[model samples]
Target: MAYDNTPSFDHLPIPLTSDLVKTEHGQVVFTAVNGAGGLETKVVDLVDGAPGAFAPRTPDVRTVIDRDSFGRELRRRGLDSDGTVWASRAKGRVTAVYNDLSTDLDDAYTRRDDRLMLQFVTDPDWSTFGNVADGQYHGQEEFGDLLDDAGHLIISHQAADLVELADSIRATSSGHFESRIQRSTGSQSVGWSESVEARAGAAGDLEVPKVVVFRVARFEDFPTVDLVCQVRLRVKGGQLLLGLFPRPYEHLLREQWQTVIGELGAEIGRDIYATA
Candidate 1:
């Protein structure tokens, strides 16, 4: 039987492309989408953008198409209002596509339902322990001091890389927060194998902004390098989706994220966005 609403991924406007970076590894492309009010912009890294390579992988296109399709379907089923889908449900699709447009259509469902993401990456050199230092800074900090620096804290492994990273965060925040260790399961695969949750105050206050500090593991075999520490502030109950394209997610996060960035910069003694 043929269904009237099989969904179409057509009629979407193509974004004009601008080459941003080209290296032996790959190229990063920037694009702007013309909309009714203004233009929406985003950046995509083309892993296979070298000459004679196949069509570039454009997850942003799939992202836009799936959003339109999902919204249309929701409106047709009379469930277009807010909160019809929980953030937890929307964030379940945790796959990242690097350079495979062949899978884009297959992954369209996941892209359609994805929760908007905001991320902050301090320079790998932000701390000696970060990826920029050739991994020489591991286990350099006093382990016991980290655990005792704040209350309600525990150290899963004295040698865990996150400890040093967490210490940098605590020092940057002026010791106002404590750290609790948590691990990512088969789900929530934002790439943090081990993470430290930072809470406010020694006893840990629930009302303050929640921060998760973790290291995004690097694939040594991959052409790209990604040995960096990340700080993710929980959005929690607010609208997770920021509709502004081209604008940095850090800005979309507004004051809350910026406050943490400033604190980190002060602690590490470098402007986080100066190189960007």
Candidate 2:
């Protein structure tokens, strides 16, 4: 079977020891593991009768692991990553996870994280973005060649506090532009999972610095992204509008998509990654 470690929206009971626990390295039998699992189990005396009580034993090496959590809502409140590998499971170097999920996903599998993001060779292709009625400064990149229904989901801030939005996707940090996945139905969709956003800021308010990479992916092989367009800022209904547009990569992205379908859902062999 495919090594499917991707997070799901299904409801599950409190996992017990011996139960298969999903990790990046495939399913492993669950153990007391850590405080999150054991604490709840030990205090409440969980049903599975998980082993014995805690004791001081040989010092075992432990690394950070991200436990999956589920949410119930239409438009999600934050970023969601879909990957098979968790580098932090083995590498004990990380202390905190305040960074973006894309970087973490990229870092887990390979060192060539830079290869995932695409560089825009041309200037802003704003030929399509022109004047609109009612003084609405609205425009959008041509997403015909790019994936449809999953392209250009608009993020409208309640106020004009997003004036610095474009500044967040500078060349130094572009992958994060649409770094956050907006919405996913958990079926029949590849990368470009419904208009990613760059709202991965450090503070709870999400002031700045959320996502930078341009993301695109294919069907098989390690999940990856290819290209991303620049962030376009405009105003509609007194709310600041933000979106990532597909400028030059439309044809290339489509070609990669077509190639993947042609090869029976094989890996996309192109250099499409999060745009940085």
Candidate 3:
């Protein structure tokens, strides 16, 4: 004879502890486990439960490669040819270093105490609303707005600041630039060097110092699947200045981005320079 059996609730998998709790103020707080194995609590009164809190973390050890080593790897990966990594920026004295996201995503993560920021830099003409009249400016405005929206979301979620250039500026040439330079103080600073250093050190094996810029295109049109372009810029005189151009689709690809970012390490390698 065949017998029928049913699953019991007592045998079902259940969490070890309560996932959420309501405070006297009517705010919902989530429970987490900290290093001490104690309950780490957080306020979850947000639509997305805090924005930047869940950004991917970089690994504690990363592959370390010099410019030459990086170039060889890029060639092996078919991302570059004939030692020409930054061919597009040939006139500019810069080289690119590529990091495979599949293997390198761990190097981008931040710890609980560490602070993260998303900075947006664009050319003055491209950043303004008036330039939207031009055909070339159509998608550019939406892209910038997307970046601004992303920044706002990040700030609201992570309680961080978004820095950008000042609006009013007098320039002699199109290349001349100015930045508003807003930063978080009182235990948080926006100086790029310190942040890079911390991120690089997160993985003891990662030696290359490069700024990873994540560029998203067609932001409004396809928010979910927006293309991401990662690039690194070189720092000169202990300072790195990026030019903002007004092109929506025109962006620095991953390979070129690495080359520009690789240049900054050369500056940091110099013994005479000092970081501000």
Instruction: Write model 2 residue lDDT over 125-178, tens digit each, in one string.
Output: 121221111122232222211212222322323123233332322211212123
Alpha carbon lDDT of residue 38, candidate 3? 46
lDDT of 3 by residue, 86-124 (tens): 222222222232232234455553232211111122323
The lDDT leader among the candidates is 1
Tens-place lDDT per residue, model 1, 9-44, is 455756665657764345778878765556778777
For residue 137, model 1's alpha carbon misses the true position, in angstroms, by 39
Candidate 1, residue 198: Cα displacement in angstroms equals 78
User: What are the models' TM-scores?
Assistant: 0.14, 0.19, 0.17
Local distance difference test, per candidate? 0.32, 0.29, 0.30
The CA lDDT at 36 in model 3 is: 43
Q: Candidate 3: what lDDT? A: 0.30
lDDT (C-alpha) at residue 69 in model 2: 14
> Model 1, stretches more than 4 Å misplaced?
1-10, 48-276
TM-score, structure 3 vs. true: 0.17
Range of the 10 consecutive residues with the lowest summed lDDT in candidate 2: 66-75
Which order, best to worst by lDDT? 1, 3, 2
Candidate 2 vs. true structure, TM-score: 0.19
Tell me the lDDT of model 1 at 182.
30
